[model samples]
Target chain A: MKIIKFTFALLLCATISSCSSDDDTENLTGKLGNIIIKFDNGVDDQDFIFGTSYNTSSGESYKLETLKYLISNIRIKDNNGDTFMYPSEKNVFIIDEADGNNAGEIWVTLNDIAAANYTEITFGIGIDQDRYALGADGQGDFLAKAEEEGMMWSWATGFRFTRLDGTYSSDTVTDEALNIHMGSVGTAVDNYREVTLSLPNMAIVREDKTPELHVKADIAKLFDGTTSVSFDEGYSQVHVDETTTGVIANNAMDMFMVHHVHND
Target chain B: MKKIFLLASALMFWLGCAKSEIQENYVPIPLEVEQPSNFPDIVYNLDNNLVTEAGFELGKRLFYDGKLSANGAIPCAFCHEQAFAFTHHGHTVSHGVNGGIGTRNAQPLQNLAYQSEFMWDGAASHLDFQPIIPLTSELEMGETLTNVIDKLSLDIYYQEQFKKAFEDGEINSENMLKALSQFMLMLVSSNSKYDKYVREEDNVMLTQIELDGFETFQNKCASCHATDLFTDQSYRNNGLSINPKLNDEGRYSIFENPNDKYKFKVPSLRNVEKSFPYMHDGRFATLEAVLNFYDSGLVNNGNVDPTLLRNDNTYGITLNEYEKESIIAFLKTLTDNEFLTDERFSEY
Candidate 1:
């Protein structure tokens, strides 16, 4: 009976040639839609701006000139528990803070998503082991893009998942150079972390609707989340260290929260 | 008999038609990548970039092309000469564009498919991504991946090769790196005298001195050089006194872990004789010097491998003159002459 009802509803929408009717019914089948995942970087509440000082929990201050983080393997789980994954060839994205608009939002628009009533969104913070294992396949021209953005290290074959470069001043250290280039070190020390956030409200996707998920990334949580890392300590330059990077990666997992979704 | 002949002829005709159809459609001719039984399981994922005739050819051309460099002069083969098992012959460390010297020795190019990590410090995680380091390094090719792709796109020959090599047929970094990987996947060199002796092929036997060397090596060096591939594929600080000029922190630079300080990868001793000027920095010119260094010349650079530490609380392996001489003799048996002159991989 449910299947028949769903098909009848879809058929009616197909005849009407409109998926987003003001009525309670939605055409969540046999239609495609586009969704923009807007990444807004902030330090707790304030927008994270370049060269703007942000205080840490440990009486340390850091201002970043460059900030970028990779987001990949984005999958939207619908209300029915069925998940729709963005095609691998186009799913990987590097969210750069400098590329943000005047509103301090970096919009990554994923197109041709299967129409669904999505309730939860899950994504990986860095290049997954599977993607890294693919070698060059599925990676079209993103290597050059990452390299141009200084997200690729010349000495190694891995991508810098998160690149935060600036100065961090502590109680003793005055504006010491702070850089956090955290990424999984090959098949060895894996630092990749995934975060799943239940949407604040149901994101209704249809052929005519362009839903936008406004996701806030709290940059402060990277150093002050589950593990409070100090700038004067070993984490001032969080690199390929297994323990320190893993702690920060876990911290980064808690950074994202979907504030709201606007289906327009 | 007549009926059987008719059936055979009909089957032959069908097979001919199918083969011709493939030819006319320009379907890529697949090439077999041999996995030698003696080596470890292949680490390079072949499913991503399958070896084809056109792809391997394209990869070989790209490997030899100087257009990959900024100045269009230095090629991959410039540093990796075939005669010396792909190392820069007699160079301590390879020299590149504008006499730019590298910090580490150029490693050999054989048996790459079986290895998971690349570089002396395991900097490259995969075989396909390894070329990007040398291609983009300022001390090496000094060319951006995009710039190289752009230059390659101009060549009509490359255009044709790309069309033939990849299905999508775009001269992009993905296809370029995949083609390179396809070519490298075929560079298996598992027919060395030592390998033959182990596999019991062609009734090959190690000489008495070589057998003695094998025994000595097994007793002393086999802890790090564990597998038949001649390496456990691990990073260790083999105590060479620190070369402060380069101040190459080895794997430490990658992870900054204090325990990883001075830790270079325990390189495979597959073709130890031909790939001379050994060690990460190529400090020792001869195998004698290398063995002697292991015997006595090892410095306690703070992180010297505990394996190299003698039970008497001293550093270095205890190798006598006879043991050293035989080990060198056995090492010579690893020189794979066939792989060195293999026409498929050769630029000519």
Candidate 2:
């Protein structure tokens, strides 16, 4: 009986010492990880291709040589309803279709994100008025970046939130100029919009892992979403017109959806 | 007990090493902007971006540096010659890299700290963002912000200057623009003969002709060109005949509002004598020509400012030859020789 008790005591002492040793390691309560947002562009069922014709709901066919837009203020909601916002200074990004890889996927890698199980993601389609009011003081390298990308107006002092430069052919006119350069007219009419998308599954982010969220953006919805603007009806050349830009901005909000998540 | 203590010591040592790696080497030295007693409150919020000696020096270097252009030859100094109050002297429209010609005449760069908006049409809302327009315009510098940053990063002088000027110096756009602002904010033109006469300094007084011209100006031109700054900071249609070739719609293109058609920002006449070939497109070559145009050449551009309306249903100032000559004399007194020859802003 004494021998059995000695062996038990030895095992208990071994377990206690091991537990104490493990407690001496560093705690990771507030650690940072990285997340990749893969933007996949599509027109209806087929993938988006430059200079390829795509038919709209209004019987007007169009082909784009350039397709780009600005995305900013990215934030993700945790499973516990807590939100983690990326730093405002570096949150703005230009998702140019020309910058896509061979697989036609434009990947925006966000660094230093708080480690969490994110359930939903929210982002702005264009620059918000709050950011614009801050002026040059708020923007770091984004002003110059926007200018380089031809996403800024030369005559005016605002960004081209969505630049779709191409030609469209209506029933009456064939191969006419189609430039949908929508943006806020200074502090007057705001075309900025925000969109929130629910994830298909929880994106489990850890220090050693980088979870990728594949987002599918339907280009068809930009013309046929909530507003359903017609090309022949003054929607082809949307510059600073309040009514035309408002319809496009509202439609752009409904274009994004979380297709899948790769928690690798 | 000894193993637990040892493990704790090891963890503490690791954290101590990590903390030392992030230790900052930033040291700040303050530089004050000289505010002229006659000028209005500065529009630039200096609190957000404090000026420093190193930052000002860096800005001067970047201003003259040709690397800011696409071809590495046309710098900001190419168009903004200091002798002409930072304007392109003798050029109706400034030329840029690759034979690119700009549309509007180059605006002067003095007393910018007091003004809220920039450019002929008030396209640039802030002082810091004003450079981005010219820097990226294809007919101006024709350079991207990223390319300029990359080029400056490779230079040894900029690398060191950026470090000394900013705390978080990374040779980025923010530091570059802030440094440029520090240099520009220091440009104050407040020592002209007119200023001396108004302040009653050094027994300076305007001659009879200049005094008469000043009175005439106060009665006729003071409504739009109000204040000592010589600008009411309002956009107006001056009724100049629109050029068919350019067809520059002015401020109407900004918002596409029909009401804002042909309206342009009223320019400050601080160095009106030196900043000749005036107006947005440099159409008028001399002060006499500008006065004649206002007196008789005013066209009904539909959106002409109602302030210039006369009793005869005409839009003009109705100035006689003597009034024009005297006003020119008074305007000449506004040329501050000290600001024109100030070595602080000199490229050499």
Candidate 3:
């Protein structure tokens, strides 16, 4: 009789413990969803400024009164280096002169992210070719905002992918009206470039505290091709061209590496 | 008795665990969405869409509500009126917050599923993203999508509607646009006389005068204004002189090819009678003036279509007073009155 009672008590206790364990997991999982990313402009203590101008070799500057671009399709690599791409939404971040101070510090609220330690972060500069053809109906926040922001050219075609406007005076000709237009639509200058970031160490995301990653960007490399062309040359008529786009994309892609991320 | 108690306790524990697990992952099953009757099965149809009636109703409310605007002055209904076949009346350029004027004319909202493009410039291609244009344009609603979503997020009504639409009760831009698209896609128009004529269900009745006008249209306008939707869905040079202020080189703006200058999207004439002052610039106040201009006053330019030039000394579409009147009369038949008065379309 004593042995039977003990067995029954053990069974009841095991079931109760299992139920409580699940409840604890649920509570922890909900708390683990918080993620925070802080962007550090490489110029320490200097206010970050994002602006556009027509590159003129003559040093004539025309400020871009309106500017907007896309940063979409983010992917994060785990400590084991296994990569997981976040489900694509608008995935666009905007920094205006007012709110973000044009320094491009923005926050995103993400949920349901599995709790893990991540080593690297990667993302696309523009929309992928597949989603670009999907049109604007279901494209999350950024692509939809592209139209409202005039970043999209029109319906027959799609977004410019990237818009870099600068006025450049030809070395031979003194005319300042010349500018470079660089973007990707067809194969001529496909602007959709992927940026991969390798962290120095792993960044852990957990329950008691949220993980924060700081990324730094360099602006000088945007004009890497124009050695003879000085910023004083109005601006480099750095328009979207095949060669120029390659240089700019390569420069921007490297900007993500200038950061330190670790567990608190 | 002891064995029975153990069994009952074990069963109860498992059932409780399962219930708690379900509560954690519970996402409401959205209503099954079905294609509307009397419309062609277009590929853009929202299949497997768990669209609910309450969601659609909420979307309709947002569509007409001017409170979404920053100044609370211009609603989507302001530029797109239901009485005018979803096209504004006689306004060359639509007005928005603080009387700001938009660059393009207000386009009619209809049969958009067939279009692979949107806007006079064809910048946007999807129905879901169309609202983004007016919502953020300084000349339109002058509000950001994020700000609008943030405002709606706080509203108890919008929160519930988003839950029904997206199976998650969170008011994000995704669900907001989804709801808006759901409402806009339902604005389908296939009940027009033109539709009836296309189906051969009814005689496309035309007076002799209207018939003469149709013949002239076939010769002069049919090249660009093709059948079915009344557009080739291509850009063309209609020979309008460039306005220095606007500097709109039409397709040249995007293509950067000077040869493509003055080429604008060929607009549909479905509800053209109501959606005027006509032309890309809204230069013509009446259709008669437009006909007169096409008859004798085409600006000869490099990119102008050769077909639009005067041939056989006919001065292009050089229609006399009678021909012009008849052409105008035929154009009126393209109006879909059923679309103009349908309360189902009204954003209540």
Candidate 4:
């Protein structure tokens, strides 16, 4: 009975030590993993669908036919405050509403993420100045992809960073154009914005495991965000104007939030 | 035993050499692209994309290949012919795949490396991204970049070409564009009579009429058509009557800037003798018409150039019949026949 008890104690100690060693060598294992960021677009509480009428805070009703925005410079901060930035060449992504699944989830899969326990993610809303200034140097398939997606203006080299094409009904007028095609125009007007969201759960990335981050984009905040805009005014037809676009871009910065995370 | 080992090593060496020659036939043979003395410093960064013989050949093949288009026709060479300095010969507004007519006249391709911007309205700031405008244009080649990449990926010849041309050997848009740029960078047209005369090469001399026209051009036209490249590289309103049907707003459509209406990039006069139907829309058919319009056909088109403002409150560069004739004669001297008939740029 004593021999059995001694054996059990050794086994128990071995089990506990092995688990503690695993926790200690969590990040030092030198294994790479994958992280999938599923962008779930919503208008307040309801899921974003094409031609769905969503009311704004400014007493305006709108429905979108087309919606696409540039998302780039994706980075994640670990619990220990180590930031893992995605590779620059493969970082930029276009989250088109038309490219989304039936569940309206636009998946941006980040490959070769270092194994760690991530707590926060920071990402930019549009193509930044550095990527834009490179022109055709580092741009590979992304330029063609952007051209095919109508996210680029045909006449110029500038990209339409956020294309929101729809009709809005205000107090004065009926369904008119609400095209908020805002973007930086050749080093002159920069509208790029970044957002940092703290994840609700700790995303433990391992070699054999895949983690998913569901980020909800409250698109209603675009019009009724930090600066409430009225469609009845000249804010309906937004393009590359320095003033109007600045407000829309500032409003768009507050659109995203980390809804949930799953380490699967 | 030593003899047996020696025989085995010799066999392996022979096999390796033979395999390279047959299967993967590629050697990085650097091609020399000359920069003429009279021309400005090269704007294209050559360090990023070095021109090799294989790369240039691949670029030329791709330029002439009809598979780049939607209907298996209309390659870049379809519109840009080598004989006319790469302009569509006798085309006012060039037709594209499926009989689709374009809005602007096809511009001549020469001295592209020296220029900062491309297209009539300065649409393409970089020569690398210039092909995208026409490749995906509905009224042009009408093929998506993805579709073209897919088509190129399917070809065995292209597979070999990509392997020979690029370091990574990937049949992608980046390599394709780089290959095309290599070919275009090599298209140097610095052997014209004007170029020869300026450089004092081959004991070339200009006639009295040519010299007289050169003087007139220097006095009046040289302000906008400046330098040996023959362009100040500035967008201007040249006082052409608007074509109401097309109604192209030029650079104004870019930012909707009211001041930029009817402004187009001043084209270089190099190879201008062959690059007619002139103007942005190819409205004029001859140098005579172009000269006459400059002399007397100036009309107020809202924002006519202040430099073109006359003492009589009209916008024009006043010129006599002889001055006009001499300017045309001088413009003809800018034609480089060596570049026109160069076998390197030719499809045949």
Question: Model 3, B224-324: lDDT tens per residue?
Answer: 88855778788888776554335567777775888778888899888778777677756565787678667754656567876676756333557788878
When just chain B is superposed on the true chain B, each candidate scores a TM-score of 0.92, 0.92, 0.82, 0.93
Docking class of 4: incorrect
How does chain A of every candidate compare to the true chain A by TM-score?
Answer: 0.89, 0.90, 0.65, 0.92
Q: What shift in Å separates residue A50 of candidate 4 from its native position after superposition? A: 44
Tens-place lDDT digits, model 4, residues B1-348:
467679999999999898667755557889877888899988988888889999999999999998889987899998898888898875557778875778788998888888889999999998889988999998889999899999999998898888987778889999999899899989989999999999999999999999999999999999999999999999999888665446788989877899999999999999999987788877666888788778766668898889999998988999999999998898899999999999989989
The residue-level lDDT of candidate 1 at B22 comes to: 55
Candidate 2 regions with alpha-carbon error over 4 angstroms: A1-264, B1-27
The lowest-lDDT stretch of 10 consecutive residues in candidate 2 chain A is A44-53
List candidate 1 stretches off by more than 4 Å.
A1-264, B1-26
Q: Cα lDDT for residue B250, model 1?
A: 93
**Per-residue lDDT of candidate 3, residues A1-264 (tens digit):** 887998999999999888988834443333444456555332211222233222323333333322234566877877666766666663555432223311234445445556677887887766667776676656766665666655665555555544434233344444344333334554445677787787776766666546666565433334442332343443344444566555555555654552666355
Q: Model 3's CAPRI class? A: incorrect
DockQ of 2: 0.01
By the TM-score metric, which is better: model 1 or model 4?
4
Query: Measured against the native two-chain assembly using Cα atoms, what DockQ does each of the candidate structures obtain, in the order listed?
Result: 0.01, 0.01, 0.01, 0.01
When candidate 3 is compared with the true two-chain complex, its DockQ is: 0.01
